[model samples]
Target: MRTCRTRAAGTAVALLLAASALTACGDDGNGAGDGAPPELEIAVGGAADQVTVPDDNPIKEALEEQVGATITSVRTPENLAAMLAAGDAPDFFRLNRTQLDLYASQGLLLDLTPYRDRLQEYIDFVGEDVFELGVIDGKPQAVVRKPAPASYVTYWIRADWLATLGLALPTTVEDFEQVLQAFTTGDPDGNGSADTYGLTGSSTAFNPFAPLWGSFGTAGPGRFYVEDGAVVNGYTDPDTPAAVEYVQRLVGSGVVDPDSFSIDFNEARDRAFQGRAGVMAAGWDAMKKQEFVDAAAAAQPGADWQQLPVMSGPAGDGYITLDPYGASFFAVPASVGEDEAKVDALIDLLNYVSTDEGNRLVSFGVEGTHYTADGDTLAALPALDEDGGYFFVYQLTGRDEETYLEVKFPDEKPFIDVAAAQPLTLVYDSLVVPPEGYTASDAERYATEQLVQFLTGAKSLADYDAFVDELTGQFRYAELIDAGAAQLDELGLTD
Candidate 1:
């Protein structure tokens, strides 16, 4: 039921491909030579760091010159819905897949399907698998930005405590449990006081022990995986209850920090910094950042925290990897399609960023000033960390993650390498959107409460069947599972 449009006339698809060529493409009355160039209002959002782009920003200037447009970078409006309703939405913006779908459904988004031939360079650069995320209702309504390399959860253990207790690095789940027991009671800190716990982590979705879950061939609850050509939610996976039982045993043994079930990731991290916990599940940046390293050193001068290899279990073992498709997407307003000049400028801008010079310009910033290149390797200058830190907001089309990481955080390379090298458990939740008439938040809350009760022994594992029944009958989880399976199949992701 889907139809495609022919490629628009006069599109400047080859403008940036040649690097030095700045010839105009689509001239719809307001062409560069005819009059003033098209003006594009691009909203910058979703970046954790607040971005302030001055009028003279080199990257912004370069993009405008290449695309033959007056690029105006602005903050994401406080009330985007209101702005869109007022018929004043920004020309381009960043949003999540859900928001993209909503806008596309409302005919507020530009359909890139008509520009498929023009977008060949970008599609080939981003790859078909990841680019598929942009398609909604069988139309390419957004541009899928290929994010940097995925970050993985890692188990950080107190190497000093192991040395003090004369214990070896744990290789298996059983060995890990024994190590936890020793760290709990053996007084590894040498303070001769009952202060330290074996493990600490955030209550994060009520499933802080991700490494443990991974050992059981699953991840935290709410993850989706394909098993034997069937889609299975992690909360109801067969291995999940067994993993929960193991957690209950750990809790009953008092090896896991009780505060872990109550605190957030930051608070859990503070416990590790304060030397109150000997092991923790965290990302490399959380455990090895200079500021955290300094904090740990200040708290316990001789403390040594190191990454522990993934522990093997009866089934298998690995850390849970972030979704490779990425969460944020780039979209253009449907209004832009009304102006051929704007459409051509937008396509030119996107195509340019995916090019070698343009990608490096936006990602690494003005070459020798922000970074230096030696053959294929790029080294960062001090300005890259200082002045160029906020430049990522301009990388609308992501960067080379491995090289970017090496250049940006050279000091953390060892930990980064370790975390990146470990085996990983892949999930497909990002690809599965629940069907209508289902309140996902309500179901998630109900599931979380049930999971917590099971872990805390408030509800016996014998009642797990009852919990699933309630989820199906009360929350309609079965409907969601079926939808997820069908959707994944349609997307060719179940394979």
Candidate 2:
């Protein structure tokens, strides 16, 4: 067994995989006696950590072993700035690309250029696109975690209900409303009760009503959109009101469950699983889980849920907003750069995970002990999930995409194909802005909230013209989209 001395207190401990199994482990077969520092503690953002971190679990021990150094974290999100001011910062941190500008201004981050050459091995492994995520203003500011899993939202409907009622998946806005009518009044579940609704929507997560915005050629629920070569808020776009009218029709006609308007996302999903609704919005990743599959199966003996094609309407091409940002990325504290040894240790640990072997270990744990595989299909041994190794990614940095796809969506080919086939589009993420003042978030808030009111008859669509005037006048809404378009132009994302 190889032993690494703890970096913090200069004590030795063995955390390597069992010597009997680790034939290709990266350690040099010597402890920290070679003058290598002990472990370097790091910070991972909630975004990246949403999926994982080593966290002193068995995975951390294994990672430390592979990199020939100890690694540790103190879970520093709540007090990171204070920690940095106190010289107690983690060696690394994770953040969105926008945050790079702020940290650079505050001198809290290490400019990653000096380390870029050193990161060539990783860049080569994952490609420049993943590496570019770390770059802002033409310099690398952080290590961006890469995404490769087939995760996207689906407009899932009760296939058994559609089959039972001889209904086809709705392809246009009008068709959808008709189907919702049937779903509400047609007794599709055949349970001999009028206890069902045609459609359900949620107040959270990738915005469940986002597709309605898409049907009108608005990429998302945000205020800013491009129309006739000019940036305009959704309230100004004629189709925006049309989309609202469709929702109001559903609610006014008694096709939508009133409870869905305020229920949590999970509860809304439960409504679909319990066979109480005909159509719903779901993410592909969450839908593929065995638990969700079982939920649908229990609704009926062989009930199936399938994704509807991206529906179309009068204004734009069919499209759905795929959140441009996924939870991932990490940055080294400026303090870490002062110590050459710590920087190299950080690089070594990251470079290790960028490779296939390291990514698998980070995600699945020990081959024989944490999981077992046959013919390329791997299953986590009971202990792996029990010990929490099944959830850690060590990623906020480099990730192996192939491993992620195989592990996260082994049977998602059809689901992915449906997403790729979606039509007419609006992508509100193009207009990224902070929430507080003069931003897309504020605009989207007004738009979505008004939509809810209009559906409930608290506000009438007849007054939509006044709503448009309010948003355009109060928010400088046109200027916002113009600025966003300029940003896209600078990035060559807009013509």
Candidate 3:
């Protein structure tokens, strides 16, 4: 075992001296003649139940041995700005790419560019594109956490209902409308009542209409993507209005459920589960979760929901939108830059977890205790669900989502595969940060309300131009678009 002198006084003094003081006390490992490893603080993001890691956590113990440091995990403080101002910040903390840009610009985050060689393993594991999310102005100011395999929302329909109605899977926009018409009027449920609806989904903005927008070769409103060599917001795209028109017709035709305009995601899903709707749009994870699967089975014995491909429209076929850039990132306080030993230890910790052995350890826990491995399959024991909530907190680098999901929820593999195979509208919407003076919440809320109104005939389609004008003019959406374009250009992401 290596030993080093404590630097309590020196650490406190250093903390007190820094301006915009994002500092925390931990062993710097710089004392003469002892040759000891540093003690590092890692700030994880989440609420109390989610982020807490007990002292006796075996994964933490195993990781400490690999990284050659004493690890202290802390929840990201609620009052972060005050903590930073008081020089009581954690050594490193979880943040999103947007927050990374803000802190990097304020000179409150460590630039990891100088230590690239030491962090190569981590950089390679998350891939270059994801790692670049942490880079600002050619300097790596944070570490991007690898995300799971991209998940996209797709249409799911009651296959049994289609069979009962003597209809094959819809392959085009017109075909889909025909199937929906049958589902609504043909009494596919065999109960001889007209209680069924053609479609159901959350009324939250343009999200519920992703496939419809894709049929028109565009994404949902507020999504920013490159088209014809320039960045453009999806709401302002020429194709969006046609997509809106299709939805209006669907609503006006009386095939869509009225409750869809007022319900939340779960409520809309319940409408599907309870046999009130024949179709729904949601991510596979939600649709195929064991609990939900059980709920649907319980509600209707013969309920058989299956993936429905995005129907082709005038422009072309399109898939649901996805943010290629993940939301999780890790940042070190600029104060930690002074301590080279500590910085290297942090890199070592991240690198260790990216290794196959370390990833398995953190993801599944002790092989025989939490799970059993046979070939590439892992069968979880009951103890895993009982005592392993803390394991996820240690998955700082993230796991291969597909493999992880397969191992954890084997029954959902078929649905997962179906989702993986579907086409998608890759959008970089998360990269756009709302500029100062822009109230995004209000703007998004208004847009959603107007969209719902347009869909339900509460507002006429003839006034759609006025809606766009208000969105861009009164909401300062144009400002956001301008800022987003400039930001993407600066990052070399604009095509």
Candidate 3 per-residue C-alpha lDDT over 22-141 given as tens digits, one digit per residue, 9 for 90 to 100: 333333343111356677777767542365578887888888888787787777788766665555678778876667777777888888878888887877888887778778878988
* All candidates in order of lDDT, best leading: 1, 3, 2
The residue-by-residue lDDT of candidate 2 on 118-204, one tens digit each, is 887677776686577566567787776664333367688887788888988888877888888999999998879998898776766
Error of 2 at 336 (Å): 1.5
Q: Hey, what RMSD does candidate 3 come out at? A: 7.0
The residue pairs found clashing in candidate 1 are: none
Best model per TM-score: 1
TM-score winner, 2 or 3: 3
State every prediction's TM-score relative to the real structure.
0.89, 0.78, 0.85
Model with the higher lDDT, candidate 1 or 2: 1
Q: What is the alpha-carbon lDDT for the whole of candidate 2?
A: 0.66
Clashing pairs in 2: 7-38, 39-70, 93-331, 219-426, 317-424, 317-425, 318-423, 318-424, 319-423, 319-424
lDDT of 1 at 406: 83
Compared with the true structure, model 2 gives a TM-score of 0.78
